[model samples]
Target: MPPARPPSRTPPDGPPSAPLRALVSWALYDWANSGFAALVQTFVFAAYFARAVAGNETLGTAWWGNMMGVAGLVIGLGGPVLGAVADHTGRRKPWLAVFTTLCIAATALLWFVRPDPAFVLPALVLAGIGTIGSEYAMIFYNSMLPDLAERTRIGRWSGWGWGLGYAGGLVLLVLALYGLVRAPGWFGIPHHDALNVRAVMPLTALWYLVFCLPLFLFTPDTPSARVPLSRAVAGAAARLRGSLRDLRNHRHIALFLLARMFYNDGLTTMFAFGGIYAAATFGMDSSEVIVFGIGLNVTAGLGAAAFAWLDDRLGSRRTILLSLMGLVVPGTAILLVKSKTLFWIFGLAIGIFVGPVQASSRSWLAHAAPAEVRTEMFGLMALSGKLTSFLGPFLVGWLTLATNSQRLGMSAVIGLLAVGLAGMLFVPEATAHGREQDRA
Candidate 1:
């Protein structure tokens, strides 16, 4: 047998260490970048992009929907290829830097998008680039887990990072809501002026830039493999080709990825459209939408905090299963509720589960993957998550367009969730269990 793997490079002592700091820095990337997900991608800009900028409500929604679908496709297809490159090169941070910088630059460009149909196409493209870049960057960051947390504490630590990310998103939401969203009149401008929305984009770009400092400064980079960059890329390409061919060989992993794809599609659809469903159904204004965003962020943070302990106590799979059950309730309620009050009530249920599910999923991966191949597996996870992203939105958008009823669009979400819930049962009960068996 091959010699036993070297004792993990992780420090063998108490919590405080260079590795812990590095992990925190990695987590902070999520903290910093979440603002884009919360304010720009989901709520405020989604409305602005769909209704205001596109100028044709139906076409705007369809256009944005298509952009997301295309992005999902690209990331789904390309993730594993790049992921293997990181593994072969032993250079996760550099990849993270390249993608994160692209995200930051694209986010900066969002400032130039005025509320006009002429700007819609470029805006959608840049937004897609930013979305794909940020998410792919996250793959490398997550692969750092083995170098940081002890196995037993992975769930709690990962949960804390997710909670911290929600908190970051919350802070940005409050700033957007109170500083820009509430002020309507700023520097001699009306509150409802379209330019007010434009102003928030620059701030988001700045937020991403500022908060990413910790990772670059505090975290130690992974040791680079001796391969030159060109050779690394070539090696990565060949390995990627082989991995795809060998996919069927990793049956349990492939099965888990399929389940993740199904459930994540549902989760993503709810997040992407929940606010729109509220607005279309209850006639919510921008201010109400802002409030809803803030509320969800708050609940999501709390949920992450609560589930951190639960994840450790019960295991990642159990936490995820419970969280999915929670999501199903709110997800179903959206179709049934006619009033804004009930929508928020149900939304609270969704917010409660969102954090735990996300945190546990990451933790589960940490437990499941071998250190040498963690980056590749995490990249594959990203691919699976993005695969059906297009389908869910396309299905919802098409259904909504055909029926001209937002309720019907949301009703479609329930089917995705139910499928996801069923799929969850098939994933292993504890990713750690699989790891232990491998060690045996």
Candidate 2:
């Protein structure tokens, strides 16, 4: 077992301010990474890969699902180990930098993927690598949250970061739409062979590279443990084992993690398929998908920012339940809706709940994790979110293939969300510094 630690100096309920510059810089990492999520994973490139590279939406969607499933599996298995390693080494920024750079490089290399069937394999490979990079980097980035914010304010800061991230994605989607895809010739880029759409890859890479600098340059990292690399690696397994055993004592957190596993998988599926579903079902084209994406981001950003205070006031557990309920309603409506107009309305409504669910989940973990094992716990958090994440995509892809209906494939998400909501009902709210709030 790791040695017992002294009590934290920060009060459990106070609102001491975090350093504004560091806080913003840390949050801006979210902004920086949003370029990849918006452009590559969620909106532009995913649509392009489906319709252009794979030569049809159906095959492309299945392939994309497989790729995401593989990536999720890798992330789920590796995140906790990496977090354990980082916890042992005691510096997270270096790991964050390495993974962020990998993502940027992989994203930039995506510029080589032409809109050809021959390019499909390369596209999936690169996108999967980039996904792995982005998700791994997030483990370290998330673990930094408790160190930055006071106990009572973690939710607000988390929401602010997610809101900023959505705004960043929204802006990038607009730029890709109008600046490149819509008018590539104006910038001396040719429109032939879908090169205009392909250009967004490098553009996203550049955006990530430029915007990610602030976090590396300004955000404070946890102090180094001064443990040698060999020692850290050697001890990681033991530490992870210890952390798992310790988790048994925190039943509420464990239950919360179990609940999160389902809902987060649903969210992951929603993100992976949202654009594809729109294009495939509604017969919307790439430009329409981007427009749809922008609208979703607008609502998601608003919801996250607006719900920031409510997370702290009403408590993270209640905030999550509310968001989950909000998601379920619109999410089901989306599956039933045949009208493109109605799809847009329900999709946008779903987005309003997406960010709050994600942001509050992060804050909840940050607020409840013991200081000694915090990073490892965040890793476990990633594990919870990703471990069965493959199931969501796999089921969607399998069902889509079986039923030949995107709608039916997507109905799996609602089931997953419902399971998570049920599980959450049993979890008590976790409060400052690993304490559970009293049920009475």
Candidate 3:
């Protein structure tokens, strides 16, 4: 094992009580980007692609799975390196801005994807680009957590961000459903060639671009390290190598990352396929899936907000364990029930757990990672969440094709979730003071 490095007593940027405006601005970025997750990735566009673009639900599902698998691989491989480079350079916002623009542009261009089978590759490519943008942007965004709030309040802020994200998804879904998809010729958008569905693409892009401004304007960013770009790039490899070596002395974080790797993959698979499965298995249309998505978002937002206190009080580990149990039970039940009504019940129940699992995981890492290498650690966090992420989607897509059963394909999530839960059992609870002791 490598010799343990001394702990960093470096305080977070800003006072313990960070300004409310900065905090809210930081949180709203979550709300902004969720437009993409809600409309493009989950409800509106995903269903449309499967049902309309590919002209075959099964083929579209498989293709979408493959596309996401590739995106995950890219994100996993690039995140740590980019994070190390950013740490050397000492600013995250510029990187965030670049990727955010990429996502917005890709989302806006999705408007050109018509209801023709010929557009399948274009649609997948655009969505893949957008997904990559959103995820890479998140590495920097999540790294800012420790700087935005003190350890005592990190859970609350993380939860608030997630809750707001879900709320944003809910609101966007409603607007897309009632104003765009369900409405006939709203704002002069014609019903011809599925233009109404395509219109949601631009709307999502506009929403993200508009709401993301506050973070750039109001949220405080890390001070520049003044390292030249060339120098930062040159040193990134060495820094990343050292960061990986240092992990040997931080077994708790390593274990937690491993546990997160499996559970997050389960979550990613669920997000990618939830709408596809609903439509393919239940014969629901795009509009119906949007309504279902709205309800799920409502429950998820409330659960995240409510659990913010629990994260701090019960500790991040317990909170995550409870949330995982909540997910595994209802998630399993949803697969068994043939009735759509039961699916709704179980699906909504699953949503309640989703927010806590994500929020607490962020808080857990915030409390655990040493301050000096925080961004690099978050990059590793992204790697853990994404490295094997392709496996979940690939398995689902493969099984869906091989067995011709959406139900059986989705069962892949259950095993992943169960494995994550068992892994969590061995990880010690993380706290702000615990981090101090690790450094000692």
Candidate 4:
């Protein structure tokens, strides 16, 4: 076996001189997957899967939620191990390619999931597997960010990615809405037929595959470590054991992870449930839901673009704190308002904060971590976020199921945000870019 390199104490030099293509490629993952989130998670698939594809609509949502929760657990538990392999092997692109193809193929196979009750379990299982693959791939992608943007400018670049992703999602959702949802008559299909919704599944697969091409073509792969795959796997297992032991040694980072876990739970819950609430409370039909999804994406894109500079200039910590507060207030307000007008108002509020939270959290972790261990750091970040990601959906599902009230379930989100904010407050300023060394 080759000698293990000493843990890198200093960050590699200030970010790369020019990593524009790398930045674009990193953002493209977001772009590629946003279609899945928008069309499958938000609008078309969930509706179709539950109402048309499952034996029971209400029960299917619960099962779908369970599948998502299981996917998150798999990702959270497995991410660090895979990321360590990437760190040791010193190649991220090949792994990315493998997972990306997995996601694309799984999404494409959804084309077969017609209005058959027997297909529910199998379809959700495929989707869960895709979710796991896409999420695991993201760990490697996030680890590359520090190489692509300067220390102070990372947040801006991250925001750029968030904007690009939303843009891609918006484009495809528009196509699905206009071409399939609105014009079924031209295709000699009924307006609310299963075929109309079925069309979106394959289109989402195509969208994800097409947009992912830029990243594969442009982004340079991390250097290979010259280790065989088997040895790399063994080394990664050893290092992960050591890293878990070392976790207690890094108290501040541990605390930060815990905090992020809870807050991210709130943020994720909002994403998972926001549309359901609108549809349930205000009675938004499919077209209105599509329009709402479009508006959210547009506003979210603008919010990311607008806040990118603010994140860099002010620092990631403040940006996250501000975003958490912004999210909390408006999110709670959604429950109070009875009218659809007010729901849109609250949704716009959500759009404003959601982009920054998503973008700045990434920058914040990059700033906090030592350079050589960036992949490990990002992997842990993904793990923490994913582990907690299940809490929101589980909580929402349970509460909604028990109370038959969306409003009651949403209250839990407020508590989650508060805990995340408080935990962040205790995190050292250095981690938040309060010190000059951190800025470097």
Instruction: Give the clashing pairs for model 3.
Output: none
Instruction: Judge candidate 1 at residue 89 and give its lDDT.
Output: 75
| lDDT of predicted model 3 | 0.89
Q: Could you tell me which 10 consecutive residues in candidate 1 have the lowest summed lDDT?
A: 1-10
Per-model lDDT: 0.77, 0.89, 0.89, 0.76
Instruction: Give me the displacement of residue 55 in model 4, in angstroms.
Output: 6.5
Which scores higher on lDDT, 1 or 2?
2
Q: Is 2 or 3 the stronger prediction by lDDT?
A: 3
Task: Give the per-residue lDDT of model 3 (tens digit) for 1-440.
Answer: 32233233347432375699999999999999998988888888998999999998888889999999999999999999888877777789999999999999999999999999999989999999999999999999998878878788989999999999999999999888888888663576778899999999999999999999999999988888788988787677777787887788888898899999999999999999999999989888888999999999999999999999999899899999999999999999989999999999999999999999999999898888877677888999999999998999899999999999999999999989999999998888886643723322
lDDT of 1 by residue, 1-440 (tens): 22222223333331233466777887788789898888777878877787778886566666777787888888888888788777877767888888888888888788788888889988998899998888888888888765567777888888888888889998887787777766643344354447677777888889999999898888877687666777766776776666656666665566667888978878777777765666567888767887888899889999998899999899888898899899888778767878778888988778989999889988887777666666778888988898778998888788778887777866767787788778777666555432622211
User: Considering TM-score, which of the candidate structures 3 and 4 is the better prediction for this target?
Assistant: 3
RMSD of 1: 3.4
* Shift in Å, residue 151, candidate 1: 1.2
Which candidate should be chosen as best, given lDDT against the real structure? 3
Question: Native-vs-model 4 lDDT?
Answer: 0.76
Question: What's each prediction's TM-score?
Answer: 0.92, 0.96, 0.96, 0.91
Per-residue alpha-carbon lDDT of model 2 for 177-242, expressed as tens digits?
Answer: 988888643466778988888888999999999999999898887778788888777687777877
Name the TM-score of candidate 3.
Answer: 0.96
